[model samples]
Target: MSQPQPERGHMMPRRTFNRWVQNPVLEDYALRYAPKSFRRWSEWTVMNSALGGIAYMADFAIGGSVALTYGFANAITSILVVAAIIFLTGIPIAYYSAKYNIDMDLLTRGAGFGYYGSTLTSLVYASFTFIYFSLEGSVMAQALQEFFHIPLAIGYLICSLIVIPLVMFGMTALSKLQVITQPVWLVLMLGPFIAIAFKDPSAFSHWVQFGGASASGSHFSSLEFGLAAGVTLSLIAQIGEQVDYLRFMPNLSTQNRSKWWLAVMFAGPGWVILGAIKQLGGSLLASWIAPAMGSKAADEPIKMYTQAFHTVIGSGYAALALATFFVLLSQIKINVTNAYSGSLSWSNFFSRIFHSHPGRIVWLFLNVGIALGLMEAGVFGFLNTVLGFYSNLAVAWIGAVVSDLVINKGLLKISPSYIEFKRGHLYNFNPVGFGSMIIAAGVSIAAFFGAFGAVLQAYSPFLSIALAFVLAPVIALVTRGKYYIARENAFEKSDRHHEIHKHSELPNEIICASCEFEYEKVDMLYCPFHKAPICSLCCSLESQCHDMCKAEQSTH
Candidate 1:
């Protein structure tokens, strides 16, 4: 076995260090580059895991609320518009993330946000996770309250606890969980629509013209359109959730080229296609159940599903049971993803700000705890308000990223060809993305508050997207992309393997420099700390070294 080399700083002994590095399941090591050895899943498996996140009940709830408030025509039209936008923006971003094996945070840094500029984006993305986490958990809590007569507080605890163990395992365990539960969840999800179609064959016609409860009826109102757009736009950040799994896609090759592209295309922008459908379904069900459960209960996902199931199943007891089952399965599928992605966002946030990452698992718990608290405090009541406000920021951030990638990287040569995310090789802020986002957010928020009166206010979300998209390229052209990359890559001469680890390993073992642990070559990197190969986890948590070795290297 390769032995540990001595370093000047205080260090843990080899055995103790090995224990710390042993946690591959919990510590997927979000802060470091993903090594080839660690990315062993097949393309199909990775795609499945990515698709699993789409099982969230929020789609149903959002759809239901829109249908109940705006009626069928506006809800369907808004969904189609949002779906097209999400698809176009998601494609290139997903392709790049899979091609590079990096997360959205890393992708944002290279796209034009700069190093720390993307850190703000991370906070935005993290907020998406927690907010959605609370929403999904609340859905689960409602199911528990209906099925088991559990108190809402106890339901919230149960909903939060179930996802922790699943997230702790990271991608490996998450992939299996998704695959195993997907078929059941899908059947349950589609069951209602199928039953509605059969039971009331003419329901579709009635649904098509339904204009909701608005004062204007089926006629379009600019204020109503803007309000609907804002609610729909909150889903813009879901692209980050897709990239979390896209990073694990197998490298494209000649033999697997078709499958590779298909996986990327379907798993990436394809998510919104399903999302729009779910939203429409929610709207329809909310409309159907509003009379029985009242308008307030119509927006609740569990209640919506329960009424839909009751229409087909006939037996009230069986209907409640099936509805609870579907709700539970759907919440578990989505909350695990929420917790997992939140951990990655938090890991990126603290590592840059504090220059320390305890581990992804630590942040995983912290993120879940925050969501749990929100669920207990009643997240459902504020759902529309929260989502509408957040949509402005979300649209602005995504608009900046997409504009820079398509314009700055494709048309202009200002930004670097690849993403450079490491702290050592990036400016603290880049005016291009940051400035575009600020202007977009500020203007849209002002409009949302009716600064230009009710007519312009409803269209604030669209304004945010347009302003950011237009501003990003202009800012990049003016700045000439000077701040995009701080340094050229110093390790350009190294092969892929060498870039990941400093030393080629013997069959059996290698040594870690930071913590002085000995392990299989798979676990080690040629870190300069002890002048030997160090395990990946130890290298991730090492705060003192200041990235002395790869100072000039770019990260995404």
Candidate 2:
């Protein structure tokens, strides 16, 4: 019998693919590696956009809530501790992500979690982005309700819809928005402190000893401290947002290595440093205003900013305007980031599971839709409960990643020196990262339900981190890193070199056989399908080929 030949087509089917990848502007290349050619933005612009994500006023609201529930001392200590941990852990994550042009979802696939293993983490990360998006959007809705008498439902829709257009242009529009809004946000952020410092300095002194709503009336209780830490740890997934922009940082050059490292440090782990300070500021402000506004109102971000505005501009219309300006600016700044990161996360999730990617814009609407649904369901009322519960999963995933980077890579030498994320080279499941995350999450969730008694139960989130960190290295040692990669390198040496070239020197264009679009050489890859290089979008949506290039090596 004659040998059979593979079916041939000039392009992949459009019916099975998404519109976002078909349209470059809408796709934003979220799921795949960020080619050198696409990374044309200056480091300052990328850093500003990443930093803009920190503009979320919810951190203040969270701080205020913790202070009111756990006492000032526990809230302050918890903020500082979580900040330190986030900063230290984020360093390696950001460094690898930028150097390799991979986001956290892709990075996980190489760092011990295999392709499928990391997909679980992608779901966890996607959930984090949307959950927080809903929380932050709810705050914006409340502000709208107070200022304009807009119904909460309508405000929620407005808040969710506004971010879609901003994200449509992807990094291009995002970078500009972040840079323009940064100065204004800083001024408004600092204005309140300046007013308080000058107008009623004694108010700060009174706030220092305020124990808030704690029955114990002391900040140093171990139980309260543990509970507070659980709530604060929920923000651990934020490193995912930092990595989104870090992937676009200009490659390190001999002349600019120092500046490059500085930018990464300041924009990466350094975000938590600023976050902790803001949390503390919020705690103090909330305590000072609690008496006048009533305890419930004081814990709300809107009221906290409103009081600060009153301190400076005095009561009535002027105060309301200042308050509204601060709230609106802060919301826009953070929500853009929330929506952007959420879209990337959803892209990561659906692409791997379904073996198809529609484009980042499709996921943008999907993320916003999920968030909007949560808002309509009244997510704000369950904020503490939701955050506390989510902390367990967030800590496990982060801890596993950190353990692989710090311990598996550093101490055990089990992980690769560089991140290997191309679909052609990774295992479907690496026991080290996958095992550790599962074990840690399992134990922590048990403790969270009082399985280990009140103290351990209260500190379950912290326990999850510690357990995952210890377990990741142990799993790597046991497995001997056999499952980390399916194949060492699939691309030819010449192709590898082509992948690393700077955008200007590389050929300006190539035609994707699948989509029939002319893209830059950097945007196209040599696919075995159609016997030509195709755009990453086409590669993602090309289900007919069934990844024939890696089929032999694929664990799946």
Candidate 3:
């Protein structure tokens, strides 16, 4: 409990959050909606920040690893197939998130999961953050070791600790950091590839013919393709990170509709397109260097790019310098995003269960600390093994949410038209999304561990997606959508405007009695226990009241 207790018989005391929590600009509305007032960033600004996270070099490592294991054909096919799936599913989720101005965890609560049901998803999303953070940080550590002769262990510490201050400022600082670095990142990333192509045109043809060590030997095997796709599918949770920034997009209107769609489409699902390209590029570079470096070391991004840069630079030291700088820039750009999003998910998860929040900044440190531990534990060594196992749960979670968004809400019309994230208005658990995710994750995990035969084991993540997608709608129908909304919203009018317009029929701003801070109407709700308007974060932390508002509303 970060909040201090109020005197007995007194109204809920105004919370005294530390400086970080008190400033919405730094906090970035973690654990709640991004209000209309706070969401003032231009469409391109938000999109750039969201897309900046894709600068991570792990895609190169994963691509190189997959190519070495499955040969060129299977690796290329699997990467493209998974990218297409990620893009199609990202459409509805991105649109709804931007329109409603809520992050993935809050979106999950209203989409199919209930108030407390999304706590599980918060954990899932948090895992994606730290896992990727460690991967990216490991790349940066390798660069430090190569350039400065720093020990790998100390390099990991330096890389992990440096991003804390950058992410502590949240979106406000990140947006500027991303915009400033985007051009330099682009030039550095593309320079080596161009140099390699120009230095020896024959290298491209040789790369295409590379069979590596795979049994298939440059040919496609269904089993190998499935296995490669499973590893790539682990990136499915990346949509959550994209929407964390997308939630701050300005409201769409006739004047900005075209720009808004372009921004969302490019920044949201569009990230996978570039990601797939990077993976292919990594695969190509691995092939070029494999004869000299050996396939065992081919998956390292630093090694792959260093060879590419050497084709043009000619000087070994100069090539290494350029490659090291590129790696450091890419790692920092992505890790800050990873740390920021992880803090939001952790804040959502812990605030719901423990009914306490020291601040988003506190959780930021916790997320980075966990990632640092993973880096020290050598998580990078088990990259494919870890991502392969994780893809099952990640696909299951995303599949359930996508089903709820496209099928249940859009096609079936069983769920609400708008997202409702307030604690007092939702059930603690909704079997539709939560149950589907659990069943899907459990079965797929069993299959992944060889509970099923070899073919099923290879395609376990795909199986998770299919089962969760089909099961979500079935559970929603069986429950008759009753769990979606526990009661009528107590904070807004019940007219057509309220249902149709996302933020209509509410005051422009209302002061939260608990925090005593004025917030946009959408983030505040009526609290019968306190008999005042309470913001969502404060309502989530008010354990003493025990949800009297929902109980009282049911009697009426």
Off by over 4 Å in 1: 1-22, 493-556
lDDT per prediction?
Answer: 0.80, 0.81, 0.88
Which segments of model 2 are wrong by more than 4 Å?
1-19, 492-556
lDDT at 374, model 3: 96
State which candidate has the highest TM-score: 3
Worst 10 residues of 2 by lDDT: 1-10
Clashing pairs in 2: none
- Cα lDDT tens digits, model 2, 113-134, are 9877898898899899889999
Count backbone clashes in candidate 2: 0
Listed per model in order, the count of residue pairs whose N, CA or C atoms clash below 3 Å is: 6, 0, 0
Model 3 Cα shift for residue 486 (angstroms): 0.8
TM-score sort, best first:
3, 2, 1
- Shift in Å, residue 188, candidate 3: 1.4
- TM-score for each predicted model, relative to the true structure: 0.89, 0.91, 0.96
lDDT of 3: 0.88
lDDT of 1 by residue, 321-400 (tens): 99998999999999999999999999888877775666788889899999988988898888777898899999999999
* Residues 1-556 of candidate 3: C-alpha lDDT, one tens digit per residue: 1122223344544687888887887788998888766777899999999999899999999999898888899999999999999999899889989888889999999888899999999999999999999999999999898889999999989998999999988998999999999999998888888887778888789877778777989988999899999999999999999999999998777678899999999998999999999999988888888889998788889998888888878899998998999999999999999999999999999999999988899999999999999999999989889999999999999999999999999999998877888898888899989999999999999999999999999999999999999999999999999898876665565532134343333336667778877776677777777776778888899988887877776787
